[model samples]
Target: MDRTLTDIPTAPTDRVYIVIPLFNDWEALSLLLEKMTKTVAPALRKRFHFLIVDDCSVTNYASLPTDTGYSLSIMRLWRNVGHQKAIALGLSYLADQPETHTTIVMDSDGEDQPEDIARLLEASAQKPGQIIFAHRTKRRESRLFRTFYLIYKSVFKLLTGKAITFGNFSVIPPNLLRKLAHVSDIWNNYPGGVIRSRLPYQSVPAERGARLAGTSKMNFVSLILHGLSAISVLMEATAVRILLFCVITAAVSTVVITVVILLRVTDQLIISQGAIYIVFSLFIVILQAFLISLLLVFIVLTYRTQSHFIPAKQYGDFVEQIEKVY
Candidate 1:
């Protein structure tokens, strides 16, 4: 039987594990942890457990104070595997714990907003089966970043026929914890993997919060890689779209070339040097288009033959060590 949030009731004493992936941003993380005590409601505070996953931080997070009214623990990874993978590893760890009923995944960077946790919990309580996402109703990023983000979203929709607007700020019910742990794509991209997994989720409106301190780690190059990873999960769909585009271009070029040749041969129209140039260009385009289409077909065929790991079954290979700190 498939599990749902409604299948499990949360008592006032039930615990909610908030999984936060950390790298070197210990300052922001400390502040966020401190803010959670006051920002989160008092009743909910009693049941909150902060599961901070350290992605092999160079800076020591061990000294950070954790006596802020809620129970706290940090799970250190073997090495830095980026934020997305860190979150996956954290979820994989929590899935095995019988005491954990609900898990919230968010960034250590304050942009996820600790204040919105209340709203997310409220939505989850009202309707129990689906995962809840803190959808950004407004952003605090620069104009350049916003422009690139919009472009990325457009290209993603064009290639995959799907849309993604949420990030790591999401609440997962117990039912999805184990299932998501099994999705290998989460190792690369969390939001994309969840979308590909076909998990039912609802979004709550929230404004993006500014970082408490320091510059963002996501530069232009990293942003491009992040966007490509999202597209990579829909590789078959994107390849098919590209292949179809090549076929359409080849067909259109052939027809235009044929018409131009016919007109020139019949002497109905004057074929200048420019017209001759266009005919040759169309031929070259047709040849290249067919070549690309053939290559894409072979790639799709090759991808199907490769074996991939299911995280729930093979996640141990990635972990170096697990530590608990309170």
Candidate 2:
């Protein structure tokens, strides 16, 4: 099968780095690298250096071919920090490097699509200073997974006051790499952290590709953790939203309790014995809401006071070794 891919204008002397995070997906990654090597322009062939962040993978692509035009470097971590942090580590590593070039952060799984790299680079070439994210136009997840994912997006928007229309597949121009490396949010969720970075960024529509190899690692629990990590990046905003809701609940409860008491005392309405229980319940609700609001305030303040996790200064601690295979 043949597909038309628009080529990006990269200078012949340009050094393009593609950073991919891996976790027990060596076979998928190998296929992805092969696809990229085939699809990229001839002048850019040897210039493309792959930075693979191996998140303590149990399996290995030990039989890696040596005749490929591109160079490959694997940064093996001492322990798995999950895919999101693995990406954070990879980008941080690149940020520390002296070379100033565009780096693309993507997944080892083929779902991110190697073909979309051109679109990312094209967007970068056009918009030099801004980071470009691959806004997925289509998803291939199961109906059940999509339903839950939709729910997650809705809640994320409602809580954070920001809509997330993209994910990890993004292009980070050289200028913004060091700045993003210092942002703490990347430790929790790369895309969410990028959003929180408050840096200039734009999105390009790219369809999600099917998995090239093994079964997906995502599950109900992983989905929840992923969502929570994203939300955690904007914890201050989420906490404030929750606090406002609690305050509103307390005020409404108080007003209803007052109305019930007035009716009970004034003989304006025939209040039964249940009226007392209703008043008591409303009072309890008010107390609970007030307490919750207070706790949220304390938490938000505490979070603000604490130090943030800067990835650049700490990424090396997780990396066990770096292997250059061809």
What lDDT tens digits, residue by residue, belong to model 2 across residues 1-326? Answer: 00111122233447777888999898888777777667766566666777888999888885754444456778889998999999999888888865557888888888898778887898999999999999989999999998999999999999999999898999898899999999989999998998888998999999999998899999888999999999999998999899889889888988888898899889775756878899889889888988888888898889989998889998888988777776
Q: Estimate each model's TM-score.
A: 0.91, 0.93
> Which residue ranges in model 2 land beyond 4 Å of their true spot?
1-13, 65-69
Residue-by-residue lDDT tens digits, candidate 1, 69-156: 3567667677788888888888887775555478899998899988898889889887667889988888888889888988988999
lDDT of each: 0.81, 0.84
Using lDDT as the measure, the top candidate is 2
Go through the candidates in order and give the clash count of each: 0, 0
The top-ranked prediction according to TM-score is: 2
* lDDT (Cα) of model 1: 0.81
Candidate 2 structure lDDT: 0.84
